[model samples]
Target: MEASEPLSGTCHCGSVAFEVSRPAFMVACNCSICRRYAALWVHAPPASARIVEGEGQTDTYIWGDEQIEFHSCKSCRAVTHWTGVDGARWAVNMRMVDPADLEGLPVRHFDGADSWEFLD
Candidate 1:
């Protein structure tokens, strides 16, 4: 893993702002919600992330497991990131990040499509 660098991201409406430190364990999952969201995720530890703006305009989506809460912008409904319970991490949506910030980063595939069986 590479050392962490603070990378900036925003909602499609530009109302929500976030910074995530890298050397993040970026993953591509094949689960339903993941597919619908079309996300590239960075599993960043809590210390590596910060919500810079629009906390009020951010809405939460709780899914089947509820172990993580997906966050989106209230206005544009752009998926931004998900946070793991217990302050463990910020599961960032790579689509919301600046393309330049993602330069030279490697993406790893995860079998979360079978997470219901494997993770259970």
Candidate 2:
């Protein structure tokens, strides 16, 4: 992909799709839910991310403090992203993005399971 092109992603079955400008880095969290989902998150300003397909077609899962809502593909059950309850923030699952686009991408480990800090 060209540097000017946005990073695009889709669920396993292509039911949900979105695109966003390449993020500075991605996050790998160790929180309970994140550990199970195994998603690599690319945080972005809410308005910068575009859900080009399957808007309102996802199944939402909210747990714990419920500060965020996880959106997944209703058909393929692929976790796509999470959004802040107040809509101020959002993140896309880079796991759903094309692997080629993720080459050399920096992944920061987050200690969401405990200290809630970046581990490195």
Candidate 3:
């Protein structure tokens, strides 16, 4: 996909949907919860990512420091995106995106499990 193209994705059951600009890079976190969810996060400004559908059809989860809220599709239990509690930051689960759309994106591995540093 073109760098300027938008990346759109939906939950497994299509209950939630979103669109974000092609991110400069994606993050693969190895933290406990992140590893379980297998989420590939792509961060963007709050205004840069848009929740296009199922605004009220998701369940939210907050743990640890509760600094972020993770939203998932209620129907399919698919993690979709996360937003900072402070509301200034946001990210989408790029795993929901088509593999074809993410062909050439750089992925950084984050060691959130311990030192909380990027492994790569």
Candidate 4:
């Protein structure tokens, strides 16, 4: 996908929908929750993302420090996106986006399970 274009995404059941500018790359985090969900995180400013639908049909999961809230579709139980409680950052689950939309984006590994650093 082109960086200047927007990538649209939705939950498995189409309950949660959103759009984000195509990112140059995405992060593969090894944190517990992320590891389980296998989410490819595309981080961006909160304002850069928009929840186009299903606002009330989603549920949030906040763990540990509660710094970020993970949102999932209540009907499909698919983790769609997450956002910082302070409204600073937003992370979309690239797994929820169409494969064609992520054509050439590289996946960077992050050691969230250990030092919370990029592993390469």
Candidate that scores best on TM-score:
2
The prediction achieving the highest lDDT against the true structure is: 2
Candidate 4, superposed: residue stretches over 4 Å from native = 1-3
Off by over 4 Å in 1: 1-5, 115-120
* TM-score sort, best first: 2, 3, 4, 1
Model 3 alpha-carbon drift over 4 Å, by segment: none
Better of 2 and 4 by lDDT: 2
lDDT of candidates 1 onward, in order: 0.78, 0.90, 0.89, 0.87
Over the stretch 1-120, how does candidate 1's per-residue lDDT look in tens digits? 245557788988899988878753467777988888889887765336777998777789888878888988999999988887766667778788878778787777767787543231
lDDT of each residue in 38-60, candidate 3, tens digit only: 99998876327899999889899
Off by over 4 Å in 2: none
> Model 3: which residue pairs collide?
none
What TM-score would candidate 2 get against the native?
0.95
**lDDT for residue 11 in candidate 1, whole number 0-100:** 89
